[model samples]
Target: MRLAIFLLIFCIFEYALTVDQTNFKTCDQSSFCRRCRKVKPDNPKFALVPGTLNIYSDSITADLIHKDNKHLFSLKLEALEQSNTFRLLVDEKTPLKPRYKVQDALKSAPKPGSIKVHEGDTEFTITSGPNKAVVTADPFRVDFYQNDILTVSVNAKGLMTFEHLRPKPQQPADGENAENPAANDVKEADEIDDPGAWEENFKSHHDSKPYGPEAIALDFSFPEAEVLFGIPEHADSFALKSTSGTDPYRLYNVDVFEYIIDSKMALYGSVPVIYGHGGGTIVPKKERIRRAATLMKNDPYTLVVCLNSAGKAEGTIYLDDEKSYNYRKGEYNYINMKFENNVLDVNFIGKPNFKTAAWIERVVIAGLGRIPKSATLIIDGASQELEILPHGEGVAVRKPGISVQQIYNIRLNF
Candidate 1:
């Protein structure tokens, strides 16, 4: 009778809860993301005057202009040791202190191959070779090629900008300060050249931009491809949409409540990943893995992103001619998220949740018997079931109605 009663109770609780709108966040909650998104065209932040590109032994660097502004700036075009990807990064490596890197939430990064640049096309180049292809430093743009065919391109619209890093000047201190009484007044501002460059206000929020403005923007185009995806944390479609009539894809991460789907708003976690599928029809018997889904969507995939700091990013993908099946995410043209733009501007941590790490950290408490180690507990499935994870060794029983409908995270603390 006791067992039956217990069984009756546990069934009432299950896991499989559908994600809703309130479970994520927005731009206002994130400090740095908000700061970067507020960047305007004439803010002197886009004042990037072209500087000379200096070629290093295996790398390159340049002195970028702050565009008649007040921020210190530099640009780096470096080569990686094993990574096949070329890096274009602009950031304040050394600031008033240290900035943050939010790269961990991302799954992985792609390695670019040794590339070749040829100038026979528009602000782009064609890259092709054995087991690899690329377009390095094309004039005004960069392009990727696959098996002697051009695939993806960046800066096609020439819409690229990098926000520089600058320190907030100290406030005037003490009563017996300076000879110029006008200079003794404290000034905090946001808009460059505006006296309010040291600080900024948005709604009820005020940001102390100690390491002022460091946002980066770039334009990417996929001429023969469509159905671009990634830049998650939104309640939108897996296939991204055009930002022409709306706000540009928001990248800020926040703690949002139950979220609505098909919207380009910011949410809890973000994956700065993208996948481009070719749009044209393939000849019969020809392999169409990379460009297959794009053809189905009847549109090409174009993507845009912003990066800053020790991290780097490359935007081009080419598939080999081989017919091997490397279909990712259970389908052709699907991509596993590979994040390289590590820009976690916040240093905040979440409360202790063992379920988040339970798969890897298999440590259990001692001094407890039947519930101690290596035992199987049957959990009833709601609509479906998943036993991907198994407890090491413990024998325990709980209220009878155990179900997967509401069991993604269970906390059994001692």
Candidate 2:
């Protein structure tokens, strides 16, 4: 009994040590996360076929069903605005439910741009501006080209899998009216409580996954880039390392107990972002808009940030009329932005999930409904160079110490 009490005291001691919320999760706290860290290389599934395509005003999305239907997998391709960055998303279409998108890092919803897609002998030509873009797609491989130079390739190694969400049926093949009433009830109960899919209770924490198995995994290779960076919220160094024999970068956002230093684990905020570094890489900071001394940084050279909304990004991107976000227009200012004019505001990026995010916002507000609005929101705008004074509850979530979030402090300059 002494040992159990000692362990409990240790956990509490560790939890009290962290502030500023930088370190989110240690590698050990997460279950599937720890499992993914120890993956092997022998087989990666690369299934691609000419599935279907949908065209909208600004963005165009295409579905890629795996050649091996054994795994119900689908990949989405999107042409976004500004630099016409092509975004590819891979996930299980009919997962138990849906996946959550954490693409709030993008300052605005990128506009849909045009791509000159032409059929080639083996591959295809997809160019937007002056660059000669190429896409070589087959059943098990995908290669991207820029100016005849192969840049990024997906599924090159082939170990991409989307753990499909399935209902726990006592027997999948059980008839609608099974002979045994007891057996049917048990099957129904199991589906309601599929431990493998949703409702994961870990370490005195109950994570109610309204949407079931929506895990996304794929291998992207940057043949030219030797160094990579940009997946903040971890205590690790700026530069990333090989998770080959280790863990794939964790993306789930959770309130970790006592996150470790220099390890791959989910944190308070997640930006599913990465960039090539070293040769021609900038200091990662951009010029400040109002000259508060903190300039936004420069974006990474190459990246693959995934955005899977509540159920899907389906029909969501099209809902926006003029909802294309470039660099400097939104709720969250882009730290490292590529903009012509200097404009900083708090906003969101990617396509339309405003409604979906609204639902999330409502849930958040409802759960913390007891907290007054005056106390809940920190009213601070960087453009005006002003801050809000927290009533009596004290600084909520942030401290206004030489940072932009000081806007929450209502201290007007007289």
Candidate 3:
């Protein structure tokens, strides 16, 4: 009798719950997103100021000016040490107050790497190792090349926008100089240009935009990319699709009740990194197993795993330390071990909840010396082919979506 009552109550609760889309704000409702999206195509507005380029050993600093507003912003380009990575930062040259910056994203400050600069009449070329970044001055654009091949371009779409900080305009008194030219101009501009600059309302919630408008936006282009992925916390496909006319892939974190699939809306968390790939080729049918095993043996996987299983599963294995920890305090020791038959066996814990599956996507294999180009999965003594797509210096393993509450004997041999 008690069990029957519990089951009846569970069914009633599940049936009563439903996702209400109106609770979340869309791109049109967001004043900043709407303003940024309205930028015309291929019309550049920002340029590097002449005689303001300051070149350093590991970085370059310059002043960028907006064509219409003439707003000045500081630009810094830095190369990180021992890694083929570059950082770009832009902010107002002189703000009324210090702006808020993200914190604790990195373990520590990265040591600076050496950079070679080749100044040109209209552009600046900075090279680190075999990769180079070409910065065009007039339009303020950057193109990145790996091994002399065009890989990624920054601000290439001319959608870059940075709202400068300024004091709020004072309202004119009802009777005192109602036609003052300065006050009239300010009032006219606010009414004609910004609709939600000071405040906005979404349903029952109201937002007093204390900062007025301080949104930053930029576009990154991958010319030869076949698939683009990342910008997580979305119930979407493994490979992201185009969001051209609709709302963009948002990166805000919010509690979305029973989120919809194939949607770019943000969920409970966000990881703002996008990876583009174009050099993935299918391995031959016969040689897939051998090539995969070899690649797996040469590298170590160092990221998250989203396991899919039906019932309780158990397995164990041993691996040599990959030397990926802080060893300066004598807390880490590197070791080398040879697995039985030189094969690494991995066990995964499955998450049967449908909503959680969308939150956890691919398995990233990192911290190894090099990323594997291919991967092989063995389940119940049968070979299952898988692709090892590249994500920066790591590899992402993706498989077909599996339904929840299914059981199978899964073994990974990489």
Candidate 4:
């Protein structure tokens, strides 16, 4: 019947294509997010150039002047000694050219820790091992810390903007002279009053920005974080709400189609990775029941875990290889979980390739609130004593030989 009415009109045009928040964009339609949310923490035209700070051995550069067009801009602050992770980077210390960076989105190039620089006068601190960052200078900020506890702050709310790169304004000949001298030297090299910095139209579609307003805004906060989750490919709601009167979580990577769930829009995959949980004090149930599970060798991987209401938990493990990036060269496989005083350790290193395939066939272990009539499994060191299952609020420790060399030592004694 004409191929069943062309498969029923392609399933009614793929269920009528959803998600169209007016085709995405707000922050007053993004002229550099409306000049970085109208930058004002008493913005006396920004600062931070006193002595231009340096401190290297893995990053911390400076120079950010713009006291009304003194214009200098460039601030970096790396520190990722094997993933403790912190990277700030503002741009344009010198640029009439080179800008656009988002390249390959990092999977390497970070390892460089052991820092310790203190300077102090208007702010400068960098410590490393229990983390610390500081770096203030009048209106420019940076914060971040861990053992001193304040975790992440960047541009505190002055909304660090950086739209520099100009030249494109000459149009004055019909008897020429509105102020023409190549349009007043491109209006004195575009001094930002920003009429969308030379062309933008949106729905009727225009955009001609042509490398004129480089656009880069900042604002990370987190402070004492009472829950904030990853900026995933949003259909929204794995708990991340509160943008204080809407729209501030957009990560940009679109292709909406059926998206309209809680909606911060921008869907179809964009992992900017945010995660912050109820902050400070209370991570000493011997470091909250020590856990270090690392099972990587990707395959439909996703492990979220954000239990707060004070059971204090934090988790994020997303392996990949949906078809191959070959886990980027190391190939991959390793899981190490350690539970402490009540004992429950696991360790499954790699490379025994029995033709690969079997990155953990089964292992459940949910919250475990109670219901421990009995449980003890220790493969590779041999010992088995299982039988416990209520599996609702918690309690379901199933297990079945996780692959590669394998060595588990589970022991839940409740």
Candidate 5:
């Protein structure tokens, strides 16, 4: 009993010291984040320059100016081929030095799509397929719409804070401003100054930053979203919570010691991709595969098959253009495959059900340089046949019947 009490007390003590929050910096400690958080909503400080838009087939570039300091920035918005994905980029028009751009970030370059521009006096809209982005001129903001529904807005809260590269200020000599104290005070009031912008000290480490602040910050709002997710590699809830009364979530990666489970502290890596979902429908099983085939008919689908002696099944299929970079537009054709005993229930409406219920046992997609009209289906080494049906730039193959708990192989010849 004495030994059991000692072990129980030790476990409680260790749980209490799981994480030390003081080792990390909060929003108040980060100068750039602190200044950005102070920006009030509805008070934007940037505007689009008139007559500076250069519209291309797949992208649109424009000049944006800061309303306060009149800083010139170049903006580019590109549309991906999947029709619903867009990439927006902003940078200094002419910088003192080249800024760092992430490289090798994607598996392949995204396939660009042709965009149609609709210009207006105060706002302009760029559209690809059913997706549209309306860009406002004054107090520059981009409202992204999927299927005509407003889903995401950039710089809507006007919390954008970009600190351009600047030379360090020379310290004034003692008594230099004593003669003109009133004038110096007026000049200081008008200057945008933050003591931590040049250097920061955490614990005993004093970082001597030679270059002035180059931190960039922007706010995104999801007006009609039911929940926000992404910004992965965080040990927090899958659905993000409001940072209203707490420090805003930080994205810098660090090797934290015994990181807190429910906190937003960065772990090993960071991928700054945040997306919001509004509303969706739950399709029934009878119509699920049919709907998936219809939705992904235009794109090439990936077929993954996993087999094991154990009675379980799992796989995935991501639909995309085989030779184009269009998959970056987000989750339009992402499908998760999971089943028990490798039983794939394929329901073909208006067709008779038979005892030989043919299902996808294994699929191998190779040398698909072109779309084929039919595919060869093989089941249990006893049956080998070709199911042929010409789809709209796609192929639909159906096998009449095959018993369950048997291995199946499908080969596509393109």
Candidate 6:
């Protein structure tokens, strides 16, 4: 009986590997995506109306209209003062009902900066320092430029779509009149045909779509980027690949079980952030060393600083001392670090009324090239030039007074 049960379980596991994935919707299956992809660059339906621009102290607002439907949309462009990042938002000017907007995700409201809007015959440009956003009137497109280099663009390939809310058509009962004359007349007046506008279904699940189709999609193009990363929380590679033949990178959060790898299928968590880098200019081979700084705070705090010799400089610092009883009682200590020109300086500051035996047990500084024959370590007011021991492609520097409760300055020079 035991042998039979074991073989049955193994067979079931093997069969589960080839389970059907028809429950997931493809781009063509989605009504909004299908309609958006059909819009050509040369013949777009949406256009920015002239003389509707409103320039404020920190943002630029305008109204865009659909040529065919005559629907109006509000467009706002703001430049973040703190980070110099630009944000472009588009929504219905006056939606019939309030549409769902994502909230509680941002750490806090962004600080806005002054932006000057330059109006021209063909386009309106918003300039803030070295970053500029050019809003083209016809065909409705926005391009972001950093230091005169085009970094990102929206609707560059003309895949923008905004499904407006409308009244759901009432279905006639069996044996009753198929359609009313007035309703048919209105349907013929509007050329757009939305088959699954009122409701959508996949497998055994049905989406009632109470507020109608309100899906918004826009294509973002990065012209001067070679590699893109982030948007993780997936069991995939760090470097994101192209989604040419497969589905686009999905951000919808789902509880996936035994999710597939190397696909755009969203897993446990979803964050709508992506980082792009590695473009333009090459540095000298000898001066290509990369450096990184990280801070880890917990019951026990730790800081990691390293330089990349062979690969990119990266490390994870775990803090296990932040949960101590003294910390909860309002006692705090800090470690300040500064790195300049092949030298690392660290200063430990302790609280006046709090005295706890806390110390950094291990400090690993990797990518030191070769173990130096001798190095200098200055602790407190004393200096000692000691022979350094070789670590894995680096050197290990240890201090005896790191655990004591006193202010000290430790400087390491290679």
Clashes of 6: 7
Off by over 4 Å in 6: 1-11, 14-23, 171-183, 187-194, 280-414
Clashes of each: 51, 28, 2, 0, 3, 7
**Range of the 10 consecutive residues with the lowest summed lDDT in candidate 6:** 280-289
Model 3 bad stretches (over 4 Å): 1-15, 187-192, 280-414
TM-scores, all models, native as reference: 0.44, 0.51, 0.66, 0.33, 0.65, 0.63
RMSD (CA, Å), each prediction: 20.7, 17.7, 12.6, 17.9, 13.3, 9.1
- Residue pairs with backbone overlap in model 5: 111-325, 356-401, 356-402
lDDT of 1 by residue, 1-414 (tens): 999888766654322234443433344544444554454532333322244455454444544444334444455544433433455566643455555665665346644334444333222232223212232332234454433335556555544555455566566677646777877554333344432345666556677777765556666666555467678667777677887545567666666454556778768877676766433211111122455654432222222221212122223223221244533322222111111322111111212111111111121211122242222222232232212222233222222222111122222322
Candidate 4: C-alpha lDDT: 0.62
lDDT of 4 by residue, 184-234 (tens): 453343377867867788888888876666776666788666777778577
Q: Per-residue CA lDDT of candidate 6, range 20-64, in tens? A: 457668876777665555656646667888889888988988898
Sort the candidates on TM-score, descending order.
3, 5, 6, 2, 1, 4
Question: How well is each residue in 278-310 modelled by candidate 2, as lDDT tens digits?
Answer: 221112222235444322222111111111111
Best by TM-score: 3
Clashing pairs in 6: 298-322, 299-321, 299-322, 299-323, 300-320, 300-321, 300-322
Worst 10 residues of 5 by lDDT: 279-288
Q: What is the lDDT for 88 in model 3?
A: 90
Instruction: Give per-residue lDDT, candidate 2, residue 356.
Output: 17
- On a 0 to 1 TM-score scale, where does candidate 1 land against the true structure? 0.44
Candidate 5 residue runs with Cα over 4 Å from true position: 12-17, 174-190, 280-414
Between candidates 5 and 6, which one is better according to TM-score? 5
Task: Report how far residue 186 has shifted in candidate 2, in Å.
Answer: 17
Instruction: List residue ranges in candidate 2 displaced over 4 A.
Output: 1-31, 34-42, 50-63, 67-74, 91-98, 102-107, 171-200, 206-212, 244-249, 252-269, 278-414
